[model samples]
Target: MTVAANGVLPRPSRRRPPVTWGNPLTYGLALAVAAVSIAPVVYVIVGGFRTTPQIVADPAGLPDPWVFDNYARVLTQSDFWGQAFNSAVIALGTTLGVVVLGVCAAFVLARYTFRGREALYTFFTLGLLFPAGAAILPLYLMLRDLNLINSYYAVMLPQIAFALPLTIVILRPFLAAIPRELEDAAAIDGTGRLGFLWLIVLPLSRPALVTVGILAFVASWNAFLLPLLVLGDVSLHTLPLGVQNFSSQYTSDTAGILAFTSLAMLPALLFFTFAEKQIVGGLQGAVKG
Candidate 1:
């Protein structure tokens, strides 16, 4: 055994780059982005605490003598609550309508390969491209014809219609991810199409549904132009319209406006806080599927 002289193979050494704080570029960039994003929220919150005079005197300074009266006023105002209620109703109604219709449409498009399927999908998607502004005049006329102007339905219906396309788009991919074998098995068991969809598809689609619901809620909540044109009645005004009214009524009352702004934003904030994870997960699932 003429073995070679005992020679050991050299092991490759692993090295990691050392971290250093002296390279503050990344930290500085992150700080800049954070400040840019958070500044408006801080301003609005601070403005809510200060009186109009204080805000005007020092636009960026902290409130010297904090006042809770603005919040109190917003809470106590009858219009505030009434408008908030109207907004809630409209947003909830729109979300429900869009999700129901969108899911049904998505199921059809995803599961059934029928004639004109692509055309139907395209037709529904076309709504997404249609600007709310473009349809305002026609919507106004239609609402007038139906005598729904200034009613919650005027705002609610259009919001549902406007949101439906995006909802369908979001849900179609999720629905497509579901195994066809499941539906076939249900069919073999004599389950009707609607039964399978209602029982199996809907349950499996909770994440996507929640994601769409949140999106619809946000869209309906933040809507301005549609409600502005349709909801002429101050009593029926949604939050966006209500905020506009608040601003107009109290243009000089900076604190009051900020208070109302903060209040108006609470629902959206709470909604995102609760459903944000679901929304992200659902989106990821849809993409992966």
Candidate 2:
């Protein structure tokens, strides 16, 4: 070590790990998996642009003469817009309910020391194993008795309930990881539990919240059987149901059916695509916590 004029030795420089381009084999496998997953979606979307005759002639060929009439027709339909509105309402409603309730419950479990708190958290965790399909019969009966059939609440409430388990699981770690010193500081400043949560915790947990919100929105948007069983009226049907109805009504119009299917799935795909980073970040934080 070299000494300075005042007899102080200089500190050694720290070395960082080398950057990696990763394994070519791993990248090749990822590309293969991605192509397998994406091929069908690409086919459906591109198929919408070809005539039924063209599709029949070459199932895997590109559209020689691209067509927009199918998409235009679906867009012009009043029922298409109606179904989109229904989907938006249900998705947004489910997201709101899940976020608000999940955060409050997670906060209590994370911060408060109460009897059976671990048990309670365990119970919610068990909810992850409870598939909606298993509860469909009893759920339908209960909703029918409540006279909630054919309404948005019938769809929204169940989606929120099913989504809550994962939401709380994702968020509790985030909330619990909040430095206890911060809470003490807030208390010294006269901030109560509610104020602390509203003023500090919520802001810190925004990533997890956004992650859960996007998940709920996408799940609600794609749900089909629940809406089918609860909403018998065509007017109340969401986009998934609308796709079913459209396909049935135009069984012979292959291109039209493809167009309608593409449109039906577009919203969820777009939502998920835009929020992909938020989801990855939230889960990483949860795991680290």
Candidate 3:
């Protein structure tokens, strides 16, 4: 400790915590993990701009002669946008449904005491333990019986249901953490429960909502089995389904396949990248609660 000019002892400075680079092992491990995770994505996206032979010859390298026409070709294909639209519709629909319903249900579960509430919440959480694979056959049969086999609703509804479990689980903690005094204060301001939800709760809960929405959107966008089992019409296929079909439709055009994959993957990557803070904050808040 250093003495001040006035003879008062100065406070010792705190040391900075070690960063990944501060420890060689930590830095090396992170680098290795990053390379492992990122290499495949880079190759696929970059490979989209290379000829099949170029990729086959040097799969690890950049395009020998970069090709933009592969993307242009995919863009020109009408089915590309159609599949994208279908994916968008399903993802957006699922996200909206999950967020709205999750918020409401989670609010009720967290704030209100009711009969069978614990039972209902437990049942919902149980859904997380059961994989989608377990319910696919029955889910398929139910949708088939409803004559929804060829419709987007068939895919969207199941996703919304499956998403609700995690959505409710994540949202409950956030909702519970909202000080009851805030609700009381809002009530004195003549806000009804619904108004409180919209004006106070919703705004305050934006982080959790955004996190839930992003998760739901990504899950729905990448969903394969539900769409595959429910949607029989080729035109209604989502991107993942479309990507599977593209393999057969353009087996000879590896560039097109890679380009299609990159395009399909781009949206979720962009979404997560842009809203990373909200997701991280939301998760931390949920965990803390």
Q: Lowest summed lDDT over 10 consecutive residues: which window, candidate 1?
A: 1-10
**Residue-wise lDDT of candidate 1 within 46-163, one digit each (tens)?**
7898888988888888888999989889999637888888888988999899899899999999998899999999999898799888889988999999999988889888888888
Off by over 4 Å in 2: 1-29, 283-289
Lowest summed lDDT across 10 adjacent residues in model 2 is found at 1-10
- The CA lDDT at 179 in model 1 is 95
Q: List, residue by residue over 1-289, the lDDT tens digit for candidate 3.
A: 2222432223346465333223455456678889999999998899999988887677677897898988888889638899999999989998999998899999989888889999999998999898888999999999999998999889888888988988899999888889999899989999888788888899998878898898788888889998988888888988888888997888988888999889888988998899888778767765764
Q: Could you tell me the lDDT of residue 30 within candidate 1?
A: 71
**Highest lDDT, which number?**
2
Please tell me which model should have the higher TM-score, number 1 or number 3. 3
Q: lDDT ranking from best to worst? A: 2, 3, 1
User: TM-score of model 2 relative to the true fold?
Assistant: 0.88
